[model samples]
Target: MSDSVEQQLSLFRYLIQTRSFGDSTLRFLDSLLVSKDVKSLVEIRSSLNQLLKSESLSIIQSITAESVHNKLIVLDFFVCAFAIVGDLESCLALRYEALVVRELKSATIQLLHVSPLEWLNFVEDAVKNGFHAVAVKACENALRCIGNSDVQKLGRDVISDNLKANTISEITRLRNFSLASITSRSVQVQATEYLERKTREQQKLDLPYKEKRCLASTSFRNGIKRQNMRKLYKRQTLLRANSEMQGQHPNLS
Candidate 1:
C-alpha cells in the first residue's frame, strides 16, 4: 500500500482502539475525516461501527451531551459510507438512530451534518418505511436550520435552480400532502406521535413472526392459553394506547 493509505489505516486503527474523545483523539479523527478518500472509507466506517457496537445502549444513553455529540459525528461519518454505497436501509437506520438520540435530548443544537444527498436518501427511506409525514417535516427543518446562507454553501448545483428556490418548492410539495398536519404539531408532540405510530405499525407487521416464536417457547404457549395472560395483554395494550393519547394531550397525567 502507499504511504498515505498506510497512514490513514493507522489513524483508523487508533480511532477504533481509543475510548477517549479528548482533544488529541479528536484531532486524529479529524485528520482522517479531512482526507475524504474513498479508498479507505469503508474500512473507516467499519471501525466506527465496531466501536459503537461495543458500547451498550444504556451506557450510550447515560453519556454526557458532549460525548453524545461526538458519537453523533461518528455516526454521521459512518452513515456517509453507506450513503456513498447507495445502501438505502443502512442510511435510513443511521439517520433514525441519530434522530432518536436527538429526541432523547442527549444534546441540544448539535447538528449531525448530513449532506443534501443523504438528506434525499433519508426522505426516500422514510417514505418507504411508511413515515412520509415525518420525512417532509425533516426536510422543512433541515432547510430552516441550515438557513439561506449555508444552504448555498452546501452547493447550488444539487438542485439545478437554487437551494433557496428548490427548498421552498420542496416544502410546498410536502405541505400539499394530507399528512402535513402532523408536522405542524410541537416538536415533542410530533416525535411522540411519530414514534408511537411507527412502533404500533411495526408490531402489527411483526405479529405473525412473534406468534411463531412464541409458539416455540413452553412458557409463551402456556401463557397464551391462560385466562390471566389474556387479561394482562389486554390491560397492557390499553395502557400503551392511553399513553399515546396522553402524549397528545399534555395536560393529562
Candidate 2:
C-alpha cells in the first residue's frame, strides 16, 4: 500500500483502539482536529443521501433533533454524516474548528476516529440493527465518564446498554407511528368509498320520486281554447232559439 494509505490506516486504527477520552484526552483530540483531512463533518447529508433510497426504519428510527442533543455520538455522527453528504453549511467545520480552540462543553464530545473500514462496520451495524441512536448515546456517555483504565472498560459497557435502550425505544415509537398511519389511511379510504357509494344509492332512490312537473304554457293554452269553444257553441245555440221564437211570433204581431 502507498505510504499515505498506510499512514491513514494507522491513524484510523489508533482512533478505534483508543477508549473514550476524558478531559485531558479530549483536549488532545481537540488539537488533532485542526488538520484538514479529518474535518469534512458537514458532507454527511449528501454522501449518505443516495444511500438512503430505502429505509427499513426498523434499522433507523426518526428522532427529534432535540433527542440527539449534547451527546458524543450526536457530535461525531454529525461530523461523519456531514463529511459524507457534502458541507452545504460551514457549521460542521466551524463547530469542529471551534472545539479545537474552546474546550468542548463540559460534556465529552466522543471522537471515534476509526479507519474507513471500521467506520463502515460501525455505521452499517447501526443501520442494520437499528441501534444508531444507542451507539451514539453510548459513545457520548463513554466519553463523558471515561476516566482511568479501570473506568474505561466499565464505562463502555454502561454506555452500550444505555445506547441500546435508547435505540429500542426510538424504534418502537416509529413502528407504532407506521402502524397508526396505516390504520388511519385505511380508515380514511374506506370512509371515502362508503360515502361515495351512499351518495350514489341516495341518488338512485331519489330517481323514483318525482317533484310536481309544472305544465308548459302550450298545454295550458290548449285547455283555455277548449273551454272558449264550448262557451261559443252555447251562445250560438241561444241566439238560434231566440230567432226561431221571434219568427214563430210574427203572425201574432
Instruction: Evaluate residue 41 in candidate 2 and report its C-alpha lDDT on the 0 to 100 scale.
Output: 25
Regions of candidate 2 where Cα sits further than 4 Å from its true position: 1-159, 211-253
Q: Candidate 2's residue-wise lDDT over 172-237, tens digit each?
A: 444444445556777999999999999999988776553222345556788899999999999999
- State the C-alpha lDDT per candidate: 0.58, 0.42
Q: What C-alpha lDDT does candidate 2 achieve relative to the native structure?
A: 0.42
Tens-digit lDDT string for candidate 1 (93-197): 667667655544422443434444445555656765656666766666555543532433333443334655665565446544525545455576978999999
Residue 223 shift from truth in candidate 2, angstroms: 8.0
